[model samples]
Target: MKKEQKESLVFGSNLNFLRTRKKLSQTQLAVDLEIKRTSLIGYEKGVQPPFKVLLQLADYFGISIDALMRYNLSKLGEFELSRIDQGFDVDITGSKLRLLVTTTDKKGKENIELVKQKAQAGYAAGYNDPGFIESLPKFQLPFLSRNKTYRCFQIDGDSMPPVANGSWVTASFVEDWTKLKSGTPYVVVTKDDGVVFKLVYNKIEEEQSLLLVSTNRLYEPYLVSVNSIAEVWKFETFNGFEV
Candidate 1:
């Protein structure tokens, strides 16, 4: 057999196995690919189609051509799978921590692979170290626990200027409310406004409301109901501050 024919036969067997595992019939696979049933039968029978058709089949099956040919089913579990705009999820369960670097784009317009690559590079460069991560404390709230290695976000707004406008701020999950003191800086997530890193204060005469203060003079402190706040991070340190 020719090289192309041999490669196609290998892919065809793997494709047939995957289809069978998925419990899809040849006719069903043809419908999903928007191809005639006879074409899928020909592919399964070791017949190669044009490059364009092969590419379409690969895309529909969500597998690379090499994977289809080599047929290593074990690697399927390690596949970097994600839905568009859903972001990537890393499970570091046994390690007691997980690093999740979500895209900075709120509109979810960034490419997922590019975002993952950037995040991975940042982590590889020791972005979590004290100097690089501690400088963020002045502008936003830091986490309560100093022991945990937290992931910092690169802030984009001038509203929290001078300290965190263009800096990376580390955030940790807050576990104890009693550890929080009045006038402490924290990253607060509310039910309505999403996340805000600001200093929190207990307002007198209003047990249900607390003060949210911004270090930037242009922004004034505001009151938010305690019930509205979902999460809080007591400020930590950071080193890299461009603004």
Candidate 2:
């Protein structure tokens, strides 16, 4: 009846169907997932599991969260669907899947979205929600949209000084960590830090970490492992409003 209810039903039915198709009994599937048997029952009964468990299920079953929550998984192409399960880095754009970063404007044109200061905390949680991403303040910067999809974030604090607090920094998504040039400014979101604008050095070569150097010498550089990063946006430009 309600949207959440509908999604839960779709997810539950899809879970059961996937398990059956994999020829795994409730107990077997539960064991494989390392979750209690009754937990599986509850999930199959339309009670949505926690986000961590949802990720585990998607990884274990080799399916995208999109397909895992679908009421009709058969509609997706085999090749596209199979690749979605390959790894977390699967580029959904290639398959035209809206797994993450569903960029769309009110008029169906590609528009740059803004992550307002108030919206930073929720970005980690709702990044996958098409509604939430679409609802983010949308506008366009013709200069940055030549051939890339950019998202702007309103930042605060004095870690990277002179940029001005409340400045809106526009950035393009960094698909390959290798392409990140050292001594570049980026607004990288990590599992630990919700969001930070930093001048970064690419240490992803020798060590699987990044040297987050601050331009303001008052602050010290720190290391962030490659694995801990959730989203990386290479800084392009910023608009600082003088207060």
- Full-model lDDT for every candidate: 0.53, 0.74
Per-residue lDDT of candidate 2, residues 1-243 (tens digit): 877777788788778877876779999999888999999999989998999999998888777676566434433334434554454432322223233475765677677888877888888667667888878877777665566668888887777876877998988877667568899999887767777899888765334467898888988899986555667788888888532
| Model 2, residue 125: C-alpha shift (Å) | 2.4
Give the C-alpha miss distance for residue 97 in model 2, angstroms: 14
Each prediction's RMSD over C-alphas, in Å, is 19.6, 14.7
What candidate 1 gets wrong by more than 4 Å, as runs, is 1-146, 203-206, 241-243
TM-score of each: 0.36, 0.58
User: Backbone clashes in each candidate structure, one number apiece?
Assistant: 16, 0
Candidate 2: where are CA atoms >4 Å away?
1-99
Model 1 C-alpha lDDT per residue in residues 119-163, reported as the tens digit of each score = 433333433244433322232223344354344555545556455
